[model samples]
Every structure is written in structure tokens, then in C-alpha cells.
Target: MAETFERLPEAAETGGWLVRDEEAVAAQRGVVWELIKQVGQNLTQGVSLTSVTLPITISEPRSYLEMVADGWCYAPIYLKQAAVEADPVERMKNVITFAIAGLSNTCVVKKPFNPIVGETMEGLFADGTQIFCEQVSHHPPVTNWQVLGPGEMFHFYGSGELCASFRANSVKGHQEGIHCIDFALDGGTIIYGLPEVWVRGVMWGDRIIEYDGLMTFHDPKNKIIAEVKINPEVGGWFSWKKKLPTDYIGGDIFKYTSDPSKDRSSVSKISGSWMGCVLFDDKRYWSIKDDCPKFELIPADDPLPSDSRYREDVSYLKAGDMEPATEWKAKLEDLQRAEAKIRKNYCQEKGINYVPV
Candidate 1:
């Protein structure tokens, strides 16, 4: 269950954490203010992240670590797959259900803080499931994560690489990564491809997110293949829609044969919104009615240096204090930059290598 917080600010106060000039109050026009002015100003040679300054808005804020880890909140579903059924078809269905469950994070619209390299997070679940993650690289902006989930029944791990660039009037994020599910049931492993993301309306309209890409699940041992398509956000200029709408993802799973020449019509079909119930073989395959199960946050008694809870900016945001949140968030980034320099110099003096992960 998600912890409840204070209500969002009044409309006149802000517009979803956007900024025009770091004003404690919302920009004059609020959401109507063109993001292009802010995003475009930062455009130096191409598209730099800090061309235009913003009048920070505090809406919903969460650290990048928590955002990435949230994807695995439904990992407990693997517990049900511990013992495979005698029938191969039933076993394959289980894989499809679990695969989709892991994508429950797609429903979230807010963006997370980009993690700094070498930052790591560790936690212990009440049920003895161990979880760990780290920002392994920075040049390519990569993150690696793992979960020893459901009483150690399976190992879930993956790495995500974010490569972003500026286009004519939009920012595109290409997520190059793969995730896997390793089961103790039959030593079967299924793999999933990451999705691509984009933030539109940044040029002259209200900023909103769009998701597009493919999610593939392959079980090498059983020769089962599941392909789920993630559709792009619907709408364009002159549209009232300002959020990524839920789109249906349906695909076919072939049994035994990965033959390119064979017809894919006879394979099992699964389709639905990534945020809601997926229909498979004309039946509901899987759905996450809520965000996810509870996650272990920074304990009041003990917290890691890189823990999200320890970040003053985020703490202020959670309490619905936008002014302090915005001020501290900027300071937090500056501090990270300074600290990175210190670490680099130390390594140079000691002739030691920096740990990427």
C-alpha cells in the first residue's frame, strides 16, 4: 500500500512541478505556460539538460532508485510459479502472467530522479527476500538491479541504459535494456525487453509522457515465445489530453516452434493495457489493481547515505513543501557534482579505480 501524503497545491500555486524561473509560486499561466521557453533556453550546441531555468513545482516526487525498484513490486507472483504444472501449455501461461506483472510501473506518469553513478541501494524484505541495485555506469547512464524474491524461489535481475537526445521539438528517451525471470520450478528463464519513453509538449504545449516499444518474453528451455507490444501515447497538438493514456498491448505466443516460415495465427493471444488487466486466450491473464505491494523505505533507525529518504529535497516534497523542496533539489544536484570531483581526485592520488556499480 502507498503511504498517503498531503494534497496537491491549489491551481494558482503550481502546475505539476514545472518551472519558468524558480518562483515559489506557479508561473503566471501555470500549466498553459509553454515549456519550450524553459527547455529551449537550455539548448546550447544541441539539447543540454539545463538551458532554461524553471520555477520549480512540487507535485509528486520520488527518487530514481525507488522508481526503478518499483517495477519489481509484484515479483511475489513468482511464488505461485514455484511448481510448474505437468502440462507445458499451462506452464507457459504462468510465464506470460508473471512477465506482464513486472511492468506494473508503466502506469506511473511522474518522472524519477536520474541516479548518480556508483550509487547503490540495499534492503531486506520481511519475508527474507533480498534486494539490491546500483547505478553501474554514468557515461552510458546505466543501472543494474536484482531481487532474490519470494523466499528465494527465483532470481530477478536486469540492467537499464538511458540514451536521450533532442529532436525537432521533443525529447526522446531510448531505453536499451533487458530483464529476466529465473525460476526454480524447472530452471526456466524468461527475458523481457525494455520500453522507449518520450516527453512531448515540451516545445510549446503542456508536457506529457509517451511510451512506445516492445516487450518480449522468451523461455529458451520450453521454446515458448511471447511478444507484447507497448503502444505510444495517444494524442497530438491541439488535444486536451495531457497525460499518457493507457494503451492496449496484445501479442501472440507460439508453442514449440519459433519458425519464421510458420504462421503465427495459431499461437495463443494475450492483449490489454499495460496498466490494467491483460486478456489472454479470451480470458483475463493478469492485472495490478494497485501501484504495488509495500516496499522497504529508509528506516527511521538506520539509513544509507544514498537512501532516497535521506534526501532533503524529496523529504520536503513528500510533505507538500514546494519552496524548500525546489531549493534543496538544486543544492542536492550541486553537491553530487562536487562530491563526484572529490572522488575522482582521490582515485587519481591513490592510483585506484572507481567502482562503476
Candidate 2:
């Protein structure tokens, strides 16, 4: 079996997210089938998949903390527009575009490394927007992140918790947490949550990734809101249909009152593919095909010791050293358990409830 398979490129192309050869695909399918057999016996409704340790062959080089940073890679493009726009409705449109831009980065299907407690990552977006993230908890893993746009145009901060379950041949993940963006001007605050993620054909068939759910953006102070529904690429088990476009999203932005359900009069219609261009009322607003700026992480002069960039397992994988990477990954898990025991003892002695530091 080939330990090294082609990694996903930053942008999507005609072929697909992964450019794996036939040999690699066959090798992965064999290992994945064995894993499914082992997990099948314990499977019930909503059984947690976190306890299953995936081999290095199917894992990506980056950590989960760094993956979260990918969601804000295009902050410079849309968030900047929202910060300066005077009209509240137009500003809300920009915010929605920014939210959708992150979807493009999720095209990669490989699983990232699970972050250890105290793991941290810091970097800058293309527009010099600074971002800092930390793994605040281990059990039912949670991460807290903050992004400060250049010139203080906007502040983005949130805590995200993801729980995934093995269901049939697919893995479904539910993202729990609220994401907020506060504009420096009178744009007030915009709050929203992420859509559910599904990894289909885990054990057989062609592997396809999809994000499906309704996302609502609210700016109560400005009396405006937006609802975007992500369309999945493939139909459910009983429905047979041609594959849909990847990252297709559509919705409406409109004015609302105390109860948004009462008013559906859309001020601007949103339609487009998240991987390509987003349209507002039949006009193009954001496009990946155009010369859109890409994300580049600015090197930190004095990064913390716990930074994800310094992880042994990730570094080994990046260097194409599979054996060491897999070994270090196991060692890290054991280290995390020992550290958790120490923390629990200290907290018990102090007579205080344990809280993420």
C-alpha cells in the first residue's frame, strides 16, 4: 500500500479535490474496509466516531486548529467591504459572501490531525488580518478563535465544537457554536452558525464531501437578516440522481422585524457556486476564478511553544516521513491523557470545577 498519496490542491479543478492514482485508491479502500468491519459491531444510532484512530495513510498533514483558520482565509475580500458599506442591507450581503467564501476551503476531503489540549495556531490572512486559535478543551474537543481585521475594520471571534458520528457508509458531523462579526462602524453585529458536514462513500463508491443545512445571519440592531441553504452534491440513499455542482449555495437577504419569519420580502437575491462566484441580485460579487487573493500565513517572530506548526506528527507528515508521523501521533495521545490526569488532580485538590484555561 502506498503511504503517500496526492494531497489536495488549494483550488478545485476539472478532475476533483484529490488527484489520487488507482493504486493509492485501491490501497486506501482495503484499509478502510477493515476499519469498517471493526467499527460495524459497535455501531448504533449516533455512535461517536472520535474514538476510532485513523491510520496515517488517510490523514492530512495539518491539525484541526489550522483547518479552522482556513474558514477565514478570504476575510480580506468580503469583511473589508462590509466594514465600510453605509447601507445596512448591502453590508449584510457582504457578510454573507464572506461566510460562503469559507466553504471553498472545505473542498479537501482528507481528515486533519486531532488537536491536543493547549495546541495553538497563529497566522495572518492575505490582507494582513491577524488570527489566533487555541484548543481550549479535549473531551468533546472545542476550539476558540479570534480574528482582527486590518485597521480594526472588524472583529471576528467564536468557539466551535464539532461532533461526528459513523452512520452506514458515511460520517456526519454537526458543528455547534455561534460565529460573530462586529464591524467597527454602525454595522452593529452579525451572528451565524455553520452548516452540517457529510463525508459520503466512506467504505465504498466514490468519496464525496458535502455541506448541507440552512444558515441564518442576523443583525438584530440593524433589523436585517439573511438565510442561505446549501445544496448537497449527492442525493440521499433512496434518491438516485446525477451529481450536483460542488459548493452550490443560494438564499435571500431582506429587512425584518422582531419576528423574521413574518417578512420574506427579499431586498437582494443571492445565487452562485461557493467554489466559483457569488451573485447578488444577478450581479457578481465574489469569485474564486477571478484573481482572488489566496491565504498566506505570516511567520510569527515569537510563537508559543504549543503552536500547531511545532507539532512533531504534523511536521513529520509534511516532510513525507510517514513512519515517524504515525508513531508521534500515538505518543501525543498518551501525553494528552497523562496531562489530563494531572489537571484533574490539581483541580480536585483546589476544590474548584475544571475549566479550560
Highest TM-score, which number? 2
RMSD of each: 8.4, 6.4
Please report how far candidate 2 places residue 199 from its true position, in Å: 1.3
Residues 149-176, model 1: lDDT tens digits: 6655678788887677655555666657
Model 2 C-alpha lDDT per residue in residues 44-78, reported as the tens digit of each score: 34678666677887778999888887777678888
Indicate which candidate wins on lDDT: 2
What 10-residue stretch in candidate 1 is worst by lDDT? 1-10
**For residue 210, what is the lDDT in candidate 1?**
51
